[model samples]
Target: MEVGQVLHMNAGTGETSYSNNSHLQKKVISMTLPIIEEAMTNLYSSTSPSSLVIADLGCSSGHNSLFVVSELIKIVEKLRQKSGHQSPEIQVLLNDLPGNDFNTMFKSLPSFQKNLSSQLEAKDAGPYFFSGVPGSFYGRLFMKKSLHFLHSSYCLHWLSQVPEQIENNKTNIYIASTSPPNVLKAYYSQFQRDFSTFLKCRAEEMITGGRMVLTFIGRKSEDPTNKEAPNSMWELLAMALNDMVSKGVIREEQMDSFNIPVYTPSLSEVKSELLEEGSFSIDRLEFSEISSSTYYNEYNHSDVSEIAANSIRAVAEPLLVNHFGDGIIEEVICRYKEILLGHISQEIIPGITNLIISVTKK
Candidate 1:
């Protein structure tokens, strides 16, 4: 599948929309707040730009988008207060793929602006500008030296597209223990290329000494196919698809042809890419574990599988529909939910890792 065109979260404010089902992503953003604060503080301390330009790459439609912007505004306000100067004219850019639900995002802006005005009234912070830039971050999306601080949460793991050569190797939807060496190599090569391009683009867009805080799914193990890492989620998802294939809900060939355009890279992989890119210095890198249960605390239901299925469906349903057609979406999700429910246990479900990295432009 062409990921940039087809890979978007479920749209609108419906039950399965990303806006409704993004608590897990919100948790990730919350975890990275300290890193974000530190980066912005360091940036302001060093340069103290009178007009701070910030961008939130892959900013999906939701409260999380505003949450990031609001936090950065607060940080800048505090910095200005400490320096005894007026807060900078903050320009916030929210970016995502072209197919993102920008309309819904725009609709939410009036309230966001009103709330922001109220919050800044006492501090005398300047009016911040917010706009949506709809496009892929895998390529250039902004003018050179336009951005000061960049933040992306739960986004970088998605590849620009599935590897072209792996069309026939359909044993799984993602890197798995059963995947062959060529399959692993293909995924790694794609990640290396895509991440290098991402860094290069950002380097061109950011001013010298600009800071970035990125958090996404990643693996703790060196092996790409390690079951203890995040690949286990895909393994379970693959099983769900396989069960459907056996029941004739989807073709075996279709299952083989489909693969998720995502990779949970190891810390070493990230460090090596940044080193090779030669435009950024790593300030901090951390890995943390979060339970699947953590994402569903707001829900009244106790079934972990139901929660897990909903979470995955919100992000994966659009892509699945693109590959398997609309008829099979509900059935596939239902089967996947059943499979996950059967496997839910007290072991904290393996293969879920979170990576947080902070860097500065050289």
Candidate 2:
């Protein structure tokens, strides 16, 4: 599948839009605030740049996009005040796939800039500029040594594309406990390639001493197919699809051919890739458990199944629509909701494993 052309979160502020369902992402950003602030402080202390260039990779449209930039600016301003140095000009770049909803994000920029301007004015800081760069992060997105800081959340787990050369894996859509060893190897190899490419590209784009803080779905287990790993979510999703196939809504052959281009790497897998690339030095690597109940608490009135289905659809709907016709999208989601509700009702749900890593360019 051409992820660049089809992969994007649901657009607009509708009930099912990613903008509405991204509380989890917001919580993640909040959790990583200390890391982000520390990185910014270190960047400022190490070098006094006339202009600070920051990029938020995979910055899907929402309040969170500007929230990150705003927070970073505050950190820089505070440090500037303490040292009595002139505040550096800020350039914030929001990046995502080509199909991302740049319009929604751009429309909100005026107000965001106004708020940023007011905040900076109170502290005698320089002006803040915002722009959108549309493309994949697996390749170069910026000029050599142009960026000072980089941040990405809930994005790296997505492989550049699905792996090739698998056969007869009809019942699963991801690397699960039931997947063959070859399938597991294929996914891991793909992640190694994609992540190494990511680090290499960023190494060229960012200056030495630059810092990056990234958070994404991952697993604590070294085994990719651990039942408690994030792959379990995909397993549940596949079960929902299989139910549709059993009822004649979608063909079994279609299910067999479908695979999600996402992988949850273990800490060892991530560290290996970082060391192989030989560009970034790991500063911190940690895991946090995000409760499924968080989603439940967000949409208290909505059924658990409905909330889960919408959350998945926000990210996967575009890909699903590309594979299966739009005609079956609603039905597929309905069945998925029902299945997820059943699992949640039985308390069989596995909470998400979030991997937060902070690194600096060597």
lDDT of 2 by residue, 294-327 (tens): 6465454346677677888887888888988888
lDDT of model 2, residue 168: 57
TM-score of 1: 0.96
Writing each residue's lDDT as its tens digit, candidate 1 over 47-130 gives 978898999999889777789998899888888888887778989899999899988888999998789777764556776888
Task: Report backbone clashes per prediction.
Answer: 2, 0
